[model samples]
Target chain A: MSRVSTLLARETALAWGKGGGPMVAVGFYAGVATLLPLAVGSEPERLAAIAPGAAWVALALAALLSLDRLFERDYEDGSLDLLTLSPVPLEIICAIKCLAQWLATGLPLALAAPVAAIALGASPQLSGLVVACALLGGLAFSFMGGIGAALSLGARRGGLLTAVIVLPLFVPPVIFGGGALASLEAGLPWSAGFALLGAYAAAAVALGPLAMAAACRNALS
Target chain B: MIPEVSIQSLALSRGGRQLFSRLILKLSPGEAIALIGRNGAGKTSLLRAIAGLINPDEGEIAFGGVEPAEAREAIHLLGHLDGLKSSRTARDELAFWTGFGGGAPAAVEAAAARLELIPLLDLEVRRLSAGQRRRLALARLLAAPRPLWLLDEPLSPLDAEWRGRFGEIMGEHLATGGMILAAVHDPLPLATRTVEVGR
Candidate 1:
């Protein structure tokens, strides 16, 4: 197999193999979705009004679930040191790691988002758009969360630090995706928010690795 | 192909404390050097600098005509950390480095066998003894052919038998004209000249 394929395969196994893979994140997503209704009281009108936005926000937070360990694990175990020696550049390595994070963790949360939103009384018709937004938003989450993970390497309270750094970055995607959903609910033009979300995700994919690679190198040095 | 290593007037400091300065060393194929120093000394840092992980405060580390960064592919660095994931099986860890380092996958079995790790291949890394883990880590040297080996206390965890085995391995590596720069407070099983750092 090619080096990238090997890395991808290894990462896939690692993503699912370590911790509980998507189960933990999806479980967290489910837990938050299940609790929101109880806490807000099961008034269908109120729940329905807030369901999509709540679900969108929950998905963004769930993406943070595994971000702390993205590169930290390898860095701790010395895998990152060896990885730097590979013919592949560290930037590509960071990208592959995030890709695996998306496949194993974010994708499941994306699937769960629509279900959670609908469970909270979001219109079933909106489920399709919910899934679409979650998919794009989740991609942004994986890549952007990676930057936080890399920067917080070798840090005290790394997990908390990652969340603090990444939460602000998550704001744009959450707003864009949530705005798209809210606009659709209100029968307004939702394409603008959706387009912004896509552009944001594309930029995150293109640029997140560079920042991650630099942070990792700094941590290593 | 063997690469010549040249270090000219290298200086480094840690935490604003000077570790060493104006140090010089050179190595050709089939040569080995043991870097000896106290705990606070920069032996490991020197190795890392040579590996291109650190920018020297002053001076240059060259791997012949290759860029120091690019020369890492031809190098194997076994630091104090083995890089093995405890949750993964020994075989899986070996497979990862093998594939990542562009080694022939077919060599995995041979590497395992050479390290006497055949029995523990299927076991998770956490289950292995420290010496066993060390041997498994060392197996990468066989799986991939890198001309320069930078080992940080490579034999510390091993019993006499395994140390002798590793000595033979190092001897074999040198016989093939590879170079070794190891950091250790203990004597290496094979003959090597010494470089004192931090003094």
Candidate 2:
């Protein structure tokens, strides 16, 4: 295998094996979805009215569940140090890590997002769009979240710092994705929001690794 | 190619404290330098700087003709952390590193055999003792042939028997024209010229 594949496979395995994999993130999504109906009085119309929005927000938070550990574990275990010596550049490595985090964490959350949205009483037809939005938004979350993970390396309460740094970056995607879902339910135009979401995800995927690699190097130094 | 690592006027500081300055050294092929100094003497920092993990406050580190930023590929630093993932088996760790470091998979088994780690390879790293982890980390050096080794207390956790074993491997590495620069308080198992830090 090439070095990139080897590192990618190793990182995916680490993310999948360590910290309960997507089970925790999926469960967090479920909990948030469960509470929405209770908090909003359990009426089917009331739940359905809020379901898409509630589910979208829940998916965003659930994605955050695994972001902190995306790079912190490697940083803690000295894997980050050794990785600096790899034939692959650090930017590529960071990109691979975020990609792995998505496979291990974001993909599962994406799959669950529509399920939770439907279970919370969203229009069943909206499932496809919700899943699509979740998928793209999850990619954005993973890549942007990587920037926070790398930036928070070696800090006290690093996870909290990561959350603080990543949460604001997440707002744009959440708005774009959730707007698509909301507009779809309201019988309004939704393609613009979906396209915007895709654009954000693409941009994040392209550029987040640069910042992540820089942060990682700074932390290592 | 001699593959010498030369450091001239190397200096570094952390926070507000200057660790060391005006440090100069050279490691020709087949030589070893033991970095000896008191605690807080910047031994590890010097090793890191030489590895290109940190910038020297005031100096130049040339890895023969290799590009300065790319010099880390020619160097391996075995620091205090073993760098093995706790959840992964020793075999997996070695295999991943062997391939990631651009070596063949066969080298993992070969290095495990050399370090007498064949028995421990199947075990998750968390289950292994510190000494076993150290041995696993050492396997990387054998499996992936970097020329300059920056070892920090490489022998602190090993028994005398394993220490001697490590010495034999160091001899073999040097015989192949590799260089070693270790930060250590315990005497290295191999012959080495001492380089003091923070004096």
Candidate 3:
């Protein structure tokens, strides 16, 4: 497990360095957060109300934007086949890859949220909750996105196809995530929202790998 | 030692296209076989099936008399794209793969030198020419310690000198009692049996 994790980390780090897409993704998130304040004027109440949703939305988009490269590059380069042939189970590989994706893209976005939230006039408490939700929700998004990424491997216009297949599935997390933040901001019991987000992440963790492995088999077929 | 690979009545399909129908082949220690076929003839597909990268719609494949998942540690496959990650330096790529294969660092370095990739070790694979990339891919064969080798179009993009050198490597592998099944368009300079993949 440690070996696989190490490999996954190395691969993800290499990927983050090689492609401008991840940087662009982080930049785009920060850019969108920065721009929201300018567009909506200096109204703190309005900014706080929209901040949580905006942050979650940005993270979701970032996760989606970077997903197509997950398996596509390796598939094109034939390294994916080597991965499949490795002694490890495909499920373990999928888990590690998803972990790596979350670490590289999702985790950074989560860590950056408090600053982005501050820009959007969110209270520190609300910002922290938003970050937690985004971390859980973003992991779920990447887990599900991996299935789409593997499915679209080697297809014509694969990037667009991946987005099309994956974006609709993002709706649940986005809704639950935004609703969770809304409840938090309203001082209502927000555990339900957190529970839902946790459930979604758990479900993704349980089933995402199988779906990814099946998609990989189909793509290779 | 266990025989490197054994296959019995392997059937595979892609998108309802029958790639192979009830194919049976076995590769034992010190054996070398060439998979010959025209383009789209399922040569690469067969190699992929053997490597366990693609599951057959029907039938089974085994390495060392065990399922691919069970015997994966003993098998090494070089598929159509050479399995080289272009974004990484040659040294980093080799280091990662050798580590994955649990190979020694010294052995991998020596293999890189033999493949004449020592100078380009720090160069990213994407910056290397096609032949250079092929050489790097071949170097992987030397780095890892595995009993069974499955190569798809191993000779693609190699110049004559490298081609001869690759043949020598293959010969040396056979002499060391390693088993190889390589798909090639041209004949290799070695005593090799032939398997016509597409009929």
Q: Pick the candidate with the highest lDDT.
A: 1
- TM-score per candidate: 0.98, 0.98, 0.92
- The digit string of per-residue lDDT tens for model 3 on B1-199 reads 3465767777777777887787888887888888888888788888877766677777767665565566767778887687787777899888778777767778778989989999999998889999999888888778877877888777888899998988888888889898888888988567468988867
Give candidate 1's whole-model lDDT. Answer: 0.91
**Predicted candidate 2 versus true structure: per-residue lDDT over A31-85, tens digit per residue:** 9998888888988888888888888889889988888888888888888889987
lDDT of each: 0.91, 0.90, 0.81
Displacement of the residue A73 alpha carbon in candidate 2, Å: 1.3
Candidate 3: misplaced stretches above 4 Å?
A: A35-42, B8-15, B19-24, B56-64
lDDT of 1 at A73: 89
Candidate 1, residues B70-161, lDDT tens digits: the string is: 78889999999999899999999898888888789888999999998999999999999999999999999999879999999998999999
Question: How well does each candidate reproduce the native contacts, as fnat?
Answer: 0.67, 0.79, 0.65
Ranked by lDDT from best down, the candidates are 1, 2, 3
lDDT of 3 by residue, A1-221 (tens): 24585588676776567467367678888988888788888788888888888887877887888888888877888777787777767787877787778877887788787788777877788877878888899889889989889889889999999999999878888888888888988889888888898899889888999999878766765
DockQ of 2: 0.82
For candidate 2, write residues B1-199 as lDDT tens digits.
3379888898899877899989999999889899999998999999888877888779888877889667777878898887889999999999998888878888999999999999988999999988889999999999988888899999998999999989999999999998999999988766568889997
| Backbone atom clashes (below 3 Å) for every candidate | 0, 0, 0
* TM-score quality measure for candidate 2: 0.98
Candidate 1 clashing pairs, residues 3+ apart or interchain: none
Kindly report which residue stretches of model 1 are placed more than 4 angstroms away from their true locations once superposed: none
